[model samples]
Target: MPADAARTDEEWTSLGRSVLLRQLALGARSRHQLDRKLAEREVPPSVASALLDRFVEVQLIDDAEFARMWVRTRIAAKSLSRSSLRRELAEKGIAVELVEDALEQVSDEDEIEQARDVVRRKLRMSADLADRTVREKEMRRLVGVLARKGYNPGSAYSIVKEVIAGAAADAAEGAEPEG
Candidate 1:
């Protein structure tokens, strides 16, 4: 950006492309995100659209690819449920179809396993959950945590029950008269 600027559409187009490329270089961004950035900078709509279209053509901007990557990393790293994943991508301006497709990567079984793992990990971390009252209160909290992460009530309840029961059985076995 200089005090003296060129007065040609070509110059504006180049500038827009530079801004867009800098963003793309940082990481994947939804089309909506990119458009908002260009708009904020007062890039002409036509120039922004043309440059964005060109970027799409060159595969520099692929919403579908971005959605897939987002789903993979988020699920693996955050253990987010399909419902949570869908909502997150939608917030990022990903298309419904793409979000659904990305969510397909997580199977129902996998989601359940993740839910179970979350409950187990949380219970293990809360050593104060020793008595029945404490366990019940902690179980409710655990179920709520899962529910907030998009787990269905039934799934969260069942997983919480299973983890608590399993821990009780382990404690019972371990409490046998020490020799």
Candidate 2:
């Protein structure tokens, strides 16, 4: 919302509607996010409440659906972990129950794969290193990466080990001469 724009609307309902639509045009927003934005814009609570109820009435605002979509997008685009996704959705003002439910969308296998994917991309650069200590150090760093992305230590260690072994196998295969 522009700083100079006056939110003091004699017709409060229309003002809320206009502001909401403008925000929505920019991107999909959660109901909580919209409420905050309206408050920041100085819209009256009564008007904001009325407008929000109407939006939800028309399916223009759905927190449950928003949580689901948000989880899916972040997982696909950023490979976030279930715990990380849950925490993020909660921060976004989605209900804790809905956040947990949305986090369920990422299966355990998907979580493992996401961890593997993170470590796999980093493993290639460390693949041919000669120092065992240096290679293990690099693997630890990769594991830390997964840990920050919300994998438990065990899962992170397992992923790091798997990717390292797979990279080694690929290197060995590539080095062998044709029979």
The candidate maximizing TM-score is 1
How far residue 35's Cα lies from its native spot in candidate 2, in Å, is: 0.7
lDDT (10s digit) by residue, model 2, range 22-95: 98888788888999998986788888888999899999888899999999899888888988888888878999
What is the model-wide C-alpha lDDT for candidate 2?
Answer: 0.83
Residue-level lDDT of model 1, residues 64-167, one tens digit each, is 99999998998788778898889899888999998888888888999999998888877854444458788888889989989988888888999898988888
Candidate 2 — which pairs collide?
none
**TM-score, per-candidate, Cα-based:** 0.88, 0.87
* C-alpha-based local distance difference test score of model 1: 0.85
Q: How good is model 1 by TM-score?
A: 0.88
Off by over 4 Å in 2: 1-10, 177-179
Mark the regions of model 1 whose C-alpha exceeds 4 Å error after superposition: 1-7, 125-130
